[model samples]
Target: MVVLMRRRLVWALAFVLVLSLTGQEDTAKKPARTISIVAERFFFSPSKIKVKEGETVEFVLTSDDTDHGFHVPAAGIDVAIPPSGKGEARVRFTAIKKGNFRFECSRACGAGHNLMRGEIIVR
Candidate 1:
């Protein structure tokens, strides 16, 4: 009877260990993120963003004036927001590289199009 009880206890501990490891893996698969950003004629709101290495970022981009573009070359994020204060564009990417990557306006809006730039810092 004692041997049977010991076997059951070992199985219970093994099950708990498996559950704990699986829970950790689930958490690792989900990345932490921040809020949204607004792109206008001359600038981007909250022009700088930061995220942890190997984590994902959720970007909600909207334009106030006309159609605009958001491009992050290093992270492979390119999106176009509609014109006339219309719908927004949502882009998601993983920050695997630890550096400062500049995101800019890929479409020409006005004289200040080149000045519309933002940066993402991954730690």
Candidate 2:
């Protein structure tokens, strides 16, 4: 009886371990949420975005007018966005901290370049 109980306990522990590992794998394999952003002279559409902490996000950037850039210093993201009808740029990052991060244009577009900014709110 003692041997049988020991064997069953070992099997139960192994089962629990497998379940925990599988859960972790599922979390790691989760796909990042994609957010499309439009950049034009002076401002970015949807200037404020909210995301969950620890979530992965992808930003697809496009410009409607002249060339521009997407710069997020806190997240270490900087990408150039081509002009309208040219092409686009993509950046991906994980929101590990819960706070607000600022993003702006790295390239000079016009007099309003400084106003071309946005915020990412991580909750």
Candidate 3:
């Protein structure tokens, strides 16, 4: 009877440890906010983005049909998104004044290379 009680106690302690570990894992896996940007033939979807001041945003950039690059000139951020492959970048900035920031694909695309531009409005 003593041996059986000890076995039960061991199992209960193990179960509690497992539950504590799981709770910690859940807290560590909290999701981060994301902003999706699609790069297609020659344009950036939405053409403009609006983001809150001082918010950390994960930019999930994807290219649809061809290889492309996402470059923010003002921020000096450049990341290439391969065709059909997902890429990610991040930006967090505080806005003291309202203005438009220009962004474009630095990579030389086809005829519309110069036209591939977008803006970010911060307020």
Q: Model 2, residue 103: displacement in angstroms?
A: 0.2
Higher-TM-score candidate of 2 and 3 = 2
Across 19-116, the per-residue lDDT of candidate 1 in tens digits comes to 45434544455546645888888888989888888887667777888878888888555676655445566566677779999999988999999999
- What is the alpha-carbon lDDT for the whole of candidate 2? 0.79
Off by over 4 Å in 3: 1-32, 85-97
Give per-model TM-scores. Answer: 0.71, 0.75, 0.64
The TM-score ranking, best first, is 2, 1, 3
By lDDT, who's the top model here?
2
Q: How much does candidate 2 score in TM-score?
A: 0.75
What lDDT does each candidate get? Answer: 0.74, 0.79, 0.63
Between candidates 2 and 3, name the one with more favorable lDDT: 2
Best by TM-score: 2
Residue 14 displacement in candidate 3 (angstroms): 43
Residue 99, candidate 2: C-alpha displacement in angstroms: 0.3
How do the residues 55-109 of candidate 2 rate in per-residue lDDT, one tens digit apiece? Answer: 8776778899998988889976677776787666766667889999999999999
Better of 1 and 3 by lDDT: 1
Question: At residue 114, what lDDT does model 1 achieve?
Answer: 90
Q: What lDDT is obtained when candidate 3 is compared to the true structure? A: 0.63
